[model samples]
Target: MDPQLQHSVAESVATVVISHPEKRNAMTAAMWRALPPLLGELADDPAVRVLVLTGEGGTFCAGADISTLRGSPQEAQGLAVRAEEALAAFPKPTLAAIGGHCVGGGAQLAAACDLRFAEEGALFGVTPAKLGIVYPSSSTRRLVSLVGPATAKYLLFSGELIDAERALRTGLVDEVLPAGGLGKRVAEFARVLVSRSQLTQAAAKEFADGRTDRDAHWAAQARASGDTAEGVAAFLERRQPRFGWSVPTSG
Candidate 1:
């Protein structure tokens, strides 16, 4: 059976819940493919300024459904790769509300987003080492971008779980929320993401993401793009300017 998503549309924020707490919401092959389209809906909705990804029953995710993986390792691995790629391609600001176990491919899912908010006691792990599975190159780069080379190496090679505080210190999570009011805090935090200027945020995110290799031409091209123009115009005009954003065209 397909796992049902708990959808919420409130105040221009689309909250997508991974509902399979019985297994800590481990994503099946189907769920992996389902995510991008669901997120795309929110990404295209002018009314939805933010897209929040979370899991049901206080758990974020435990990675790809391992039991299913045991059946056909190659197929399951392909699904994870495809899903991760889709997530990375999503345009707009994305946030993850992480609680409980965020392990293996779950960690990949969180890392794909623009921002992460984890509650106290959240556990994060990259378990490919344990399974002898190789992570995709882009995912590895994203992880390294999040926490830097040494920390990324530690997480990848060690596959050890890190607490929320440690994850925050390592830059794995943008912020740590109190365990008691985590849900409400996630909602409030998502509001901040929603209220932020899409133009400025999108450009900044794009600029930061593409800055890794430092291609002078690519950087200049982004600035030449109308996003920069609209951002400057909005600031000078003291008004909101619509941003016509699409999936980032550059790596």
Candidate 2:
């Protein structure tokens, strides 16, 4: 199938699938350009509490379609970078479900997510060095944030493929599961996220994203949202909290 970005929702989680079996789900320039808007639409959906990104045919993205690189290298790079930034800035929690090859730009997309889960035999690499090209500084920093500077340098400098065990050891992946049950596992986690208070999740996500000055504002916002009261009531009543709040629509 031709490469495309498609989304579906179930159990309050929007799953974005990258499909291009012929090329191991490598993204075309058009797919990259489509990502930000797709993510935006999902972000605006109040019912979608989380996002799960993955690839079809057992592989995550292999990278940008190199066959098209020679024709519009600059455009492809720009679109990919924009898509990465959009994913990183997505308001809700985003998870990458990696099954097979996640290399080059693929690694960037995975790093942009809030969490990453990979199958036990998945392979990962950053191949800019192999192509005599430079990795984007922003993506490099994100990689460093996940796996530390030294390990990030190792991947960038060597462009060598690492197994799931190595990726987990380096902090690149949060969980490693046996193949065939990845979707079930991710859905379980996403359901947990869906049941939680959006207020708390948004505040924590903002902090984790490196914004520290919003403490007072978030505290006020939380009080106004009434999630705290509902949570306390539910706890005392021995029932699950029915959180009604969603991220406020930005102006």
Candidate 1 at residue 69, lDDT?
82
What's model 1's overall lDDT? 0.81
lDDT per residue for candidate 2 within 1-251, as digits (tens), equals 55788899988899999988899999888899899999989999877899999999899989999986898677778888999999999999999999999998899899999999999889999998988877888999999999999999999999999999999999999999997888889989999999998888888988998997999999888778888899999999999998877986554
Provide the TM-score for each candidate, comma-separated. Answer: 0.83, 0.97
In model 2, the runs with Cα more than 4 Å from the true position are none
Residue 81, candidate 2: C-alpha displacement in angstroms: 0.8
- Residue 213's C-alpha lDDT in candidate 2? 97
Which ranges in model 1 have alpha carbons more than 4 Å from their true place? 211-251
Residue-level lDDT tens digits of model 1 in 159-191? 888899999999999889887777788788787
